[model samples]
Target: MNSLLKVENLQMHYFTSKGAVRAIDDLSFELMRGETIGLVGESGCGKTSLGTSILRMPTPPGRYVSGKILVDGVDVIPLPEKEVRRNIRWQKISMVFQGAMNCLTPVYTIGRQMMETLNEHSDLSRSDAESLIAEYLGLVGLSPEIVQRYPHELSGGMKQRAVIATALFLKPEIIILDEPTTALDVIVQAQIINLLKKLKQQFSLSFIFITHDLALEAEISDRICVMYAGKIVELGSNAQIYGTQSPKHPYTERLLAATPRLFKKVEQLQFIPGTPPDLIAPPKGCRFSPRCNKAFDRCFQEEPPLIEIEPGHMSACWLHHRG
Candidate 1:
């Protein structure tokens, strides 16, 4: 499979009066063409930050500290801001932000906003851009006539579809969907998920699906990347992450235990105790050692590297590294 995106030792931090917040610390992953990699973690675990870093659009005070973001074999981290916006952002990769309801401007019609994106990125004529917008809107299961309506006139599901349609208008190879099904009814969420699968098959596109819901991730992802405290703790196939095989990372185990299972009878849903560590000054050795029940002296004294515990499965934990 062709490699579409490669993130290597990518460190993105936010500078403040107090100290630097290590939002993404030495994170590395490869995204193959026409593949879906699900990023699952609790909030503030750097799922969204990783997405923004790939697009080189980290919010103010948030800046790239080190490492490379290679999209299609070309490193984008060192590119100029203007060059990144013109050649990389939206052209190669685009993002569907967390809240679809809040993504659109109430004053602007859907067509107008989408048209602006086309105008900024490409040299498509007005008629051509409008036609493309309509085509994409229909592609996402929204009616062409819906493009004329304002955001305030659309339902939550409609708005979400519209946002997705806009992301497709750029003809990007990869899309980072940050909680795409969020804040919608169960039926609507299913509809959106179906639409995404259809689109992925029809276009041969790759996706980075970011969400806190593990079940939803299992439905769409070919592989799963589990993140904690601004780093990946485990990465493996969906079956390896959710199947009978025990997870290599303690965090991964606790996360699966916390999620309710439909097929299996549940006496109680277990939860991970304590909050995530502070990014500004996280623990010295293993960031999860403080909360991990299986922690030992080695876990608190030395950070573990992400190493393959089994074929095509990697985990960063002392448990996997112990002699």
Candidate 2:
């Protein structure tokens, strides 16, 4: 499969009053054409930062610092701000942000927002743009009448559908969905997930789906990348990630144990002890070693590099490296 997007050693650091915070540290991954890769991690683990970095959105105190982001073999990192804006940003890549309900302006009608996005990216006239907006709304299983309503008038699920419609209005090749269903009801969430799967197949769109929900990722993701602190600790197919082979990385195993199984009712559920390390002043070696039950002297002193353990499975842990 051809890679639609390739991110190499991507780093996004924030210079705070305390010190330099490594929000995203040496992250690298590839999105194959029409493949869904789930990025799962606790909040503040650089999932959102990674998505924004790809789109080159305003980072404020955050800086790209280093690394290369290639879209269809084109090095997007070196491109000027204007060129990235005019050529690449929305024309080729788009994002459906978390809290899509709050993302839209309450005062503006759904149709107007979609039109603004369409007109900004393409040379379509008002009528042509309106037609396209209606088409996209319908594509997401939304009624065309919903377009005329203000965001405040729509339900949470409907607002999300409209937001998705806006993101897909340009028909970009890659769409980054950052916890798109987090705020919806369970039934609504399932509906949105189904819509996304349908859209991916219909348009052959590649996606980087960011969420903390492991079970949800297992259902929708082709491959899963488990993140800890500011790095990808494990990358593998869904089966490799979810199967009971005892994950090589202690953190990955803990994450799997934390996932709630529908058929099982246990008195106590396992939880990963201790919170993620502060990025402002991260630990010298493994950020997860403090909480990792399998931590050793080597894990606490040496930062492991991501290495392939199997054909498509990669893990960054001293245990895996030692074996």
Candidate 3:
């Protein structure tokens, strides 16, 4: 495989005042070059944590207990913070966080912030840096004048586009976008999604798109990974996971059932019945067993491993477990 990024047995945990929370538990996956992979899960299910951990930029209280994050076959997990900041981040991989408001510093002008990032990474003159930044902003449908505006001055969609532009300015091979269109209206969401699609092709980029909506994933991703309780329950091509009548995992099916389809008549949208398991004190068996319709006695007693049940599809569940 022409893998651009590979995460192996990744475990990221947060040591809160209460207890240790496993934000990412034994997660593993790969992103092929120029591929778009969607990560979908409910809130606090490690989607954001996984995305942050990919850049090795965990906040306080969070730590990478064990894992291998490789970019272009080079292991990044062992790199020092300085090395990661200088070489790995933004240069090889970058992230546009969930909230655009949080992404940009309100006090700083967009031009100054973008220039600082550009100059820090490359030894470019002020004029050269501004020129390059403007070029990138243009790629994301922003005008050069946006550089002079503060974060508060731009519209929500514009702020998101600016953040995306900053991410792509470094020309990174992989970019992780966490709910890029979360707060925008439907029309704006479509516009941003379209912009992303165009940029990906323009730069031959690979993307990890994280969102709560599976329907959105189906619209853009070549493959989608269903995350639950800090672990991926299923991973497959969009066709195998969504196009098929039966998804290998019950959790995946329930998610699809819960999604509201436009212009499609349905009496009611099915809802997944329970709250997600507490990460600080997660169940010992399958993390998703509590909500899985196909759960059996064994499922509640032992955790399932992610194993391939089809040519390119992998799922962790008792129904597909071969042991």
Candidate 4:
């Protein structure tokens, strides 16, 4: 499969009064065309930062210090701002942000918002833009008439659908879905997940689905990347990630244990011992070593590089690499 998006040695750092915070460190991954890749991690694990950096969105006090982001083989890291705006953004890559419900304009009707998106990126007149809006809304299983309603009048699920519809309006090749169902109820989340599955097939789109929900990611992703602190601790296929076998990384195992499964009954779920280390002044060795029960002397003295354990399974723990 050809890679539609390739991120290599990506790093994002934040300058603060305390010190330099390493938000994302040496993260690398590839998303094949028409594949769904899930980025799973706990809060403050740089999942959202990774997504935003790919799109080159505003990151105040933060900068992309190093690395390469190649979309369709074009290195986006050092591309001129004008070229990125004119050639890369929106037309090729788009984002369905985390809080998409609040992204809608309260004053404007859904139709107007959709039309604005179409007009800005596409060469469509007022009437043609309105027609395109109807087509996109229909694509996302929403009625064309709903376009006339304002954001305040629509339900939470409806607002999210509208936001997704707007994202698909440009027919982007790669879409970053950053916790699209985070604010919705269970029923609504299911609906949104189903809708995403449907759209993925219809559009043949490659996605970077960022979320803390492990079960949900297992359901939709082709591959999973487990991140901890500011680095990728594990990367594997969905089966490798969710199979009966325990994950190699202790952090990954704890995350899987914490998730609530449908059939299994977990009386007392195991919790990770300590909080994630501060990026401003991160500990010397492995960032997860302090909380990890499997930590040893080497774990405290040296950071482990991500190494391939099996054919496609990669882990960055000394235990896995040494054994």
Maximum-TM-score candidate: 1
What's the best-to-worst order under lDDT? Answer: 1, 3, 4, 2
| lDDT at position 235, candidate 2 | 93
- Model 2 lDDT per residue over 78-116, tens place: 889889867888778999988867978878888888887
lDDT for model 1, please.
0.92
Per residue, candidate 4 scores C-alpha lDDT tens digits across 1-323 of: 89989999998998878887899988999989999999999999999899889998637788898999998888898888888877777878899988978978788888888888777777888888888888888888889999889999988998999998888877788899999999999999999999999999999988899999998898799999999987999999998888876677888998988887779888897778779999988888999999999999999999999999988999999997664
* lDDT of the structure predicted as candidate 3: 0.89
TM per candidate: 0.98, 0.97, 0.96, 0.97
* Local distance difference test scores for all models: 0.92, 0.87, 0.89, 0.88
Candidate 3 off by > 4 Å: none
Candidate number with the higher TM-score (1 or 4): 1
Q: Would you list the clashing residue pairs of candidate 4?
A: none
Separate clash counts for every candidate: 0, 0, 0, 0
lDDT of 2 at 134: 77
Record all residue pairs in model 3 with backbone atoms less than 3 Å apart, i.e. clashing.
none
Better of 1 and 3 by TM-score: 1
Q: Per-residue lDDT of 200-282 in model 3, one digit per residue for the tens?
A: 99999999999999989988899999999999999999899878446888898899889999988799879989899999999
